[model samples]
Target: MAFSEEFLSELRARADMESVASSYVTLKRRGRILTGLCPFHNEKTPSFTVYPETQSYYCFGCGNGGDVITFIKNIENLDYVEAVRLLAERVGLDVPQDSRYDAGLFERRRRMFEANRLAARYFFKALYSEAGQAGLAYYHERGLSDAIIRKFGLGFAPKGWENLRRYLNGEGFSDRELFEANLIRKSSRSDRESYYDAFSERVMFPILDLRGNVLAFSGRAITPDAQRKYVNTSDTLVYKKGENLFALNLARKSKAGSLILCEGNMDVVALHQAGFDNAVAGLGTALTEQQAALLSRYTSEVLLCYDNDEAGQKAIRRALSILEKTTLHVKVIRMQGGKDPDEIIKTHGPERFRALLQDAANDVEYRIMQARGAYDVSTSDGKTAFLTDACKVLADLQSPVELDVYASRLAEETGVEKAAILAQAGQLRKTVSRKRERDRLRDARAAAAPAQKAIDAVNPERAKRLRAARAEETLLASIMHNPDIFSQIKGEIEPDDFVTAFNARVFAAVGACMQQYGHFSLSMLEGDFTPAESSAVAAILAQIPNLADTLQECRDCIRVMREEKGKVGRGEACSLSDSDFLKLFKP
Candidate 1:
């Protein structure tokens, strides 16, 4: 769906690329670009560069680049319309609606949101009522305070098949609406009247979005004899799994500028009640890429506050793999004298938990500690193996100074020779660099294969086509980097003149977006391009030279393209055009 140009323009003007990017990435000013770690992928070096002058960003490491809107779309895992709406909300403006989606779509989402909110209030009230006594006792046994319980919108699902179903239905919600909102469900019995409350005899936790909308709920069993341990809201029109963090609604407001990621909702709740409101938890057993991106949008760092159990430690390793893909600085919080943050808080009080947060180990330190935990460092063979693995890890460090520091530390910790470890690390770096070069070359060759199979059976015709494609790509890159070049060439070339269909389509999108916004914006074209096309566009823009160099190359490319087109056309190859660009390129 298309948004109004005026609204999009205003949105762009308000959401500065640098400022929006800085919200997720720690950007350092570097000449015309703000260089930072790419939030789209893992990289020790800062390959993600934001060009504020053009209101765009490009990541050399991952080739995920676009304008501010596109950045927000991908970073937040939102659709184009949703991304625009979010930005508009940020600037206190309303987005103009499009009719492509049914008008009731918004109404359905609103009703679902309202239903969940009302259900939460109903459940919360019940927690204090006689029907909620069991749930209240459970919370008390777990030592949950009144304030903390209310803060999370925690409630109790009264025992019975239709307690919540009846409660919400009386509040003007139909049974079908209740089911759609995940508040009620049908039984396995084949009878048509088999409806029952989705959650029964459980302590309920309302999961809210960052905007404080009650999108869903999670119910923990209060009775041991309950058939299930935990029951959560199924996906609904308004809620999605692996998307919203349990406590991000409150944690996003924290001034810590960092987040504490835990494995369970109770851990997050406990940490928040202990005065660390910056805590959030992964929804499932492991952290997801979507969750990581969401956290990056709010804070620049994450403290992994998973439990100390084997599963929890394993989850931490998995989480690190995902978190590194974002710009957030990661640290591990190992709870001592307890199993998880909740237990730690209860056993040692809030001060010890605060101390743990302060003393969290950086990812690198955690990795080395993990390596040491794997074997007896005192043994000669174990030390050798540890040094070998440690050096391999150290080899991948982007900084030579970091390599030296870690290498020395490894030597001291393992009683190995510092020079020997350094030598091994150097060799490992060479191997890794060579492998990366091979992988890059492989990727280039793969990208070179035509997206749409244009006839390339013969070598000469294929070569001609490849050259033409290059010229088309170069010219498109020029316009993408410099909007002034767009009008200069718009009247001269057709999309058909481009050899590749994908590039032609992207070129068309660029022109359309530039015309609509009265400016060049990569994000404006993002809605139409596929992921591969977006990556291709990013690769083209990431390697752009200076404007003078780009203009010269663009001219050469245009000439080559025109020459190739002439070869396949009825016109004379020697015919000269009256266009000013042709005259300018006459020399």
Candidate 2:
């Protein structure tokens, strides 16, 4: 799926970076670049910058720098090929079908998509068949209507080993493709290879992406004797379980201002059927930071509608901790007379559940109530413990009026003086504020050296020869800033002369770009390196603004790398003795 440089260039030209970025980030002109708050990570101050000249962007706060394609890839959660296609469609340019494309990673993912799509169709067809009668009855017992079932593309996996295996095999899918899609499991018995359906006698729920492609499945067992009532698709080529929400594809389309976060697929469907279409659930996993960020993208708030049990309460706490870091407002939906949303809707009806949602508690209110439940506020020691927990929760409240309101309530409940409670909460708030500021300072220092910090995790030698690595980074950054410098430094520093493999690869790529286009931009490295590597390269070049004399700095940096290269056993510096390492880095 690789595009020609000319097509990419044309696409980049038609889809201006500034225009494209403005759709997501509220950017303001800053001399040669534009700045905005980063959408990748939550930040109060704007650190995300866009360089229209290079058709590139880099975030100082989160280090998510890349070309427009990379931006779309991360923002929309798509693969490289998909992102390119999206950008092409955006600019009204048809992606050229290049047969030279390797049928490796991208092709494998395509096959998985096809397999999942066909599997979903087969399951839905099976739901209406004789084998799926019990599953249909199970849905009926749960009160899911025919229209609601079809809207969610509900299906049934029949009881047997070869049901899906036989159907998909007839549909021209290889066993490997089905296995990779998590639709079937492979087995070897008596020296013969065999495959079987992964789900059996279960009501099938096809988890889809934003594009409405069936990515995976979560099945609830229909029979009583079946082990593990629910069996979800393992992470496959087409899906990462924790990275996706179950019904988000449909939920995203809901006009509802907030999303109701549920615990299971049934709860989501039930809530959606009851006119709460913005309900979504995790894919058979606990809430993830990634999922939380995904939720923040579509909604202004998230209503935690998990079950009314100990495990569900724990899940709510875990979810609040992650969601609190995002910009989204969060509330907890405390259910009554039922275990889960489905049970609540079934028992007291959806109207009662709707009323509960209307009166849902904010995260702070929820935390304070949880604290009250943890200890007896009437007793002295219990009152102290409750106050301590309540103050910790109150400390995070951003609004002064809200904090005082909660504090006054705590004082009234415990019969403690209102001023004393306020004083304790204020002290806790100051302590938390100091700790956050210290963390922010430490992170700022780490971010200052993002290039070295990023490489240190994978390239140990880069850290050992810090002087040489920094020099290499500067030389590369200079060349990226002014591609003409490559002509001057080409003879002085070749790829092999570099100490770091990643920098060497980038240098080689830069040399190739310079030779072909006579200029280099961050977009040239789009397909060659990973998203993280591209961001690191952007980070390296972000330091170039201070370089007054690019040609001389490039030469000076090249000289430093050459000096490091002249050392004996160049790459062995990382394994050297402490004194030897110090001497190797000596000026």
Candidate 3:
């Protein structure tokens, strides 16, 4: 009961690349093609191009190229099936339910998701129940209202190991499910398995995914003397610490042009309660590339709302590196007279916090201010060092306008001439460019040397076959890219008809795509093929010279391979003849 090729074809047919891509990017008509900035990565100029005739898109800047399904998969951060389902839902189509899916694995994952959902509900109920009086009083003291508490699914884990264990068991859930879900830990002293709640005597905030499914939870201790201030669920099948952002389920729905990224659950909850519903927090971990990609999907801008402390400043720098790779416009929110966002809101109210967000400086300007605060700029040596360091930071700015403005600011702060700072910035830019060029050349040489070695080691007979196989791979990839070629050469070729295993897989995948989608596309074959096959196909497509002229080239290569086989059968040394070699090199 594997997914039928016909169902996939229908799904692909229903998914319009132009329509799906336009939802995330501002696509402009460009003579039978469409152009837009790549939503996958940051760029001031548009390098993401879509060809409606081919139903494919390729980002020249980042090298992320694929068809409609690939676009949805990357943009939505979903797996192949999930992306297919999402697009299917969008277009009012049904995903064929196949019986081949592992029922046990699916049920176990569902139970885990269900266990978390029920536990969150129970925790919320406990906060309002008579047994949660202490927790309720703690929230009241902190000025949190019922609305805020309920909005965040604020819950109290009663102070006992068996409370949740007994409750879930009484509700007919097996003990194994609880243990597997990581909701309870077993006691090490007694071999007898007992359920110990993961979070106890703490306020809980349910962490959700972009789809609004509860993936995990984070709990903060109410007791002042509590040894652990915060406890988060260990990574489970559904939750990866580096991949999820707290409250993104709600934030992505906001009309706010940017996201306010905070450091803690309370900070995110507080900001949301204060009408900044676009705020989200990382899972008490450094921001990651995966998380940055997730943020880039909802909005093109982000404000790093870390605590106003030394450690917080360090986290901002780390976040900057990750965010730099994405399309999100980034700025750092620097709080004054408060240690964190929650405190800032509590002490001065939402208006003050909003003002801070509005007045927040760009990362470089913020770093300059931080540097000025860290060192005394009154001395000539200190001022010179500060200006030099600040200029280097400004040079990293992607925009020329931003760099120029920040350079002028650096000059003003250090009482240095703008021309001097600009000169230094130009020098740094040249150095960076030279380093990049050198690295590129080094990589090219490294790659070419290996292929050269492979060619050198191969005997004439094997080398001829390998070259022929390579040509066939390129032909198959091109046919997959534009399947009209498939019909023209259908009778002459079959993937099983190829000799090499790698070539056979490529042809098989192309045949699969053509049979399924009526046209073969790289995106449609994403999860359908093995990684090695995908890489081989990509390499072939990328390296094949003059794709339009390669049809006859591939036919000639196959003919030469056949002729060599004939010579070997005649008890001769297998080699390409003059006429065969001429055909291969012919225009």
Q: Each candidate: how many clashes?
A: 0, 0, 0
Candidate 2 structure quality by residue, lDDT tens digits, 90-167? 889988886544486767877888888888998899999998899899899999999999999999998888988888
- Evaluated against the true structure, the overall lDDT of model 1 is 0.78
Model 3 CA lDDT for position 365: 72
TM-scores vs. true structure, each candidate: 0.76, 0.89, 0.82
- Candidate 3 Cα outliers beyond 4 Å, as residue runs: 25-81, 102-106, 170-172, 192-195, 397-404, 426-429, 436-466, 482-484, 494-499, 512-528, 531-546, 549-554, 560-587
Cα RMSD, each candidate: 7.5, 4.7, 6.5
Model 3, CA-based lDDT? 0.73
Model 2: which ten-residue window has the lowest total lDDT?
450-459
Off by over 4 Å in 1: 92-111, 165-188, 191-196, 234-243, 255-258, 293-301, 322-331, 354-464, 480-488, 506-543, 546-556, 562-587
Model 1, span 1-587: residue lDDT tens: 37666777788999999999898888999887889876765545677789877788877555577788888877765566667788889889977768764345555676788999999998999999999988888888888888999899899988788777777778888887888887888788885666888888889999987667888888999777878888989888877777778888899889988999888888888888888999888665478776776777678889998888788888999999997766679999978879998998899999988888899998888888888788787788888777787877887788889988998898887777899999998999999999978977875654334322222221224355677766676677678777888877788777887655666776888888777665766655544766555656665665555233555566777788777776765334345456843765666
Give the whole-model CA lDDT for all candidates, comma-separated.
0.78, 0.83, 0.73
Tens-digit lDDT string for candidate 3 (198-254): 888887888877666678888889889889998888888667888778888888888
